[model samples]
Target: MIRPSILLAGAVSVFSPFVMAQDDENKPWTVSTELGVIATSGNTETTSVQGKIDAKQRLTRWHNHYIFSALFKEDQVTQDDGTKTTEKTAEKYFGSIKSAYQLESEHSNFFVFGSHTEDEFGSYETYSTVAVGYGTRLYNGETMQLDAEIGPGYFRGERVLEDESIQRESGVILRGAASLAWQISPSAEFKQTLSVESGEDNTRTVAESSLSTRINDAMQMKVGFNVANDTDVAPDKEKTDTMTYVNLVYNF
Candidate 1:
């Protein structure tokens, strides 16, 4: 089992020196919360909910980001005995933290990243990774920016089998990621991100695209699509999963 507390504590310890040297009062944290919900009745009964929190802090030489998100869905189904019941159809939780130290260059940094995920109905029941890498700005323009990173990492995960058995897998991995952000207008923004982890046992890939339009100074509406894929999976499981959501975001 990959312990989240251990990884978080390690990250904090690695960055404690920078944290202590910087004056936190002058550098405030920025946070955003997003929520999406859906409910249906009548012919078909279903409910779905998603929530996310994103936080960031910037000091003189260090930048930190934290993210947590959860999704849950339930559906009403008719059983063999002609009885109707509600059953959970999907459940997933994910969290990640990244801290970067600015180098002498204008847009370059060294970063440490850690993430964990739990999915009740996916190929992998639990997965976690830690990596250290160098990142740099690939493009800087008036309305668009791009950043990319590559690193060697380690990952451990639990895989579900066709027989309803759990198998543990762990290995060294090479990770690469990139992000693109475009300011379409003063109140509208578009973003895309992709990440891949290649290991001995399996290769995992994730991609997300989102567009947000500001409704006010502190609120916005966003629509996003996310996809996750694994090269290796159980016989009865699909290799890919996708989600589309519309959410309300509050920023502070």
Candidate 2:
């Protein structure tokens, strides 16, 4: 049987990459790295880092946005039997490319994007996923906007647990995200996001909000909070497990 703590780690690890991959660029590229510490079950701690590089270019009558992300996790958790287990050190990579076609008006645009994720866990297990989505944005003011998207995806995943038990599961996935961005001024902004995801034994619903402040033309800092509940996520557990996390972001 998989432990509860290990299940939680897997849940958190899967969705953490979406924080920095949703940018829309106008030929202005971006690159940045972030580091932070997360408290894993009371006294144990996990260090998380993410690096991103993105660029945008125009393709005739349409514009394309391309962003790539990499994430690394280092941490340890004490198991239920009082034994210490270092959660597998894993590296995650992600790519999202969005393209929009102009519709003669500034506020009217349409786009479709594909996102890919690959996870490598120190030779224990690896998984890959691909999702494609269609969305539109309503841009008002200089930076205030709203964007919504929906997608269907699939996962090709296999896992090998510490007990030497292996499990293979892959199924249909549904995802949707809507974000509202408010530019308070030239140097500050606020954002609220709603995301829904449904997978095999997991149906996750999350709400997040963030605040961003620019330090200069080239750098920005932000912080956000996420509240989520997982229903039927693990077959062993009958009820939902609600989780909350605080995150900080940097853009350069």
Candidate 3:
């Protein structure tokens, strides 16, 4: 078993030097919020909303990142008997935090990360993960950047069954992730992220892509698409889910 206390001590010991080497004046924090919504009426009635927040702080030796996002969707449909009803088709939320310790080599670091997720209709009531790994910048240039990371992790969750009973699942897993950023122009940028976690029970993968165009110094318009897949799921459950959004982002 991987003990959290041992992991914490190891991470602290490895990152302390970087933290001690940082100068005060160079540290800065960046934060942003994004909101999106879609609505339709008449023949088909639907409403969906999503919101996300991101924050990052970087020092000479350490970088920290945090993210939170939530989505809710409901649609109106007519029953086979001709009656109309409003049903909630989707609801999900996720949050994560990570910290990276800069190594002596440029563009390389060791990181610790954790995340939790909840979905109203998903296979699990709540899913959580913790990982530690090494990360490196694959490409960095004026207009584009790419980074990749790999590590070992643990996953534990309670799943919902058709009988309304809950079953617990826990396992050790491997995690791999990559991110890309492209500065298309002064006022526009594109981003993509991919992550995968595999364990004996199942493998999960997620991909997200988005483009943002600045409307002003403090705001931007963004279009994002996301896909999530699970290699193993209940017979009555789906193997994949996808979402699309048009978001307005505000920087603070």
Candidate 4:
């Protein structure tokens, strides 16, 4: 099992240098919280909620970020007897922290990243990965910025079988990630992120795209779409799941 205390200690050790580099008066932390929701009624009754918090800190030669997100969904059906039955369709959460140390080359850095995910209704009950990789800014222009990273990683997960038994799988994986941001206007921005973990047994992929527009000094409105795919799944389980939602974001 992965221990949160160990992760916290590692983060503190790596970020201590950056902490000292920044002046106390002007802290380098940036934090944001977001909430998304969707509901449907009539022929099909469905509801979903998602929440996320992101925090980052930047210093002279290092930048560190932490992110936490959760998603929950439910569907309801009206029986012939006039009773409503509700079932939880999805529940998942993800947490990760990444720290990058700059290299001599421009727009290049080395980073250590670790993440944990749990899903009640996914093919996997829990999954964890740790990787160290080189990341580079692929493009930086007036209105666009893009970054990419690739590395070897370790993955461990417990898969849910059709018969309700859990199968533990652990192996080496190749991790790849890319992110792109576009500044559409003074108050509107678009962003996309894609991540993949390829192992001998299965390949897991996630893609997310969002557009956000400023609503006030600290609030923004956002629309996002996300897709997840697992190449290997239990019998009768689909390989893909997709979601669309609208959200409110608050920046601190």
What TM-score would each prediction reach against the true structure? 0.89, 0.58, 0.86, 0.84
Candidate 2 error regions (>4 Å): 1-47, 54-60, 76-93, 103-110, 118-133, 138-143, 151-174, 199-208, 226-232, 235-252
Q: Model 3, which residues run further than 4 Å from truth? A: 1-27, 162-164
lDDT of 2 by residue, 139-183 (tens): 555667898777887655555445545567567788787879898
**lDDT (Cα, tens digit) per residue for candidate 3, span 167-217:** 888899999999999999989999999999899877889999999998887
Clashes of 3: 0
In candidate 3, how many Å is residue 113 off? 0.5
Q: Report how far residue 89 has shifted in candidate 4, in Å.
A: 1.8
Task: For candidate 4, write residues 103-171 as lDDT tens digits.
Answer: 998789999999999999889899999989999999999999999999999999999899978999999
For model 3, name the residue pairs that clash: none
Least well predicted 10-residue stretch by lDDT in candidate 3: 6-15
Clashing pairs in 1: none
* RMSD to the hidden true structure, all candidates: 8.4, 8.6, 11.0, 8.6
Better of 2 and 4 by TM-score: 4
lDDT of 1 by residue, 116-211 (tens): 999999999999999999999999999999999999999999999999799999999999999999999999999999999999999999999999
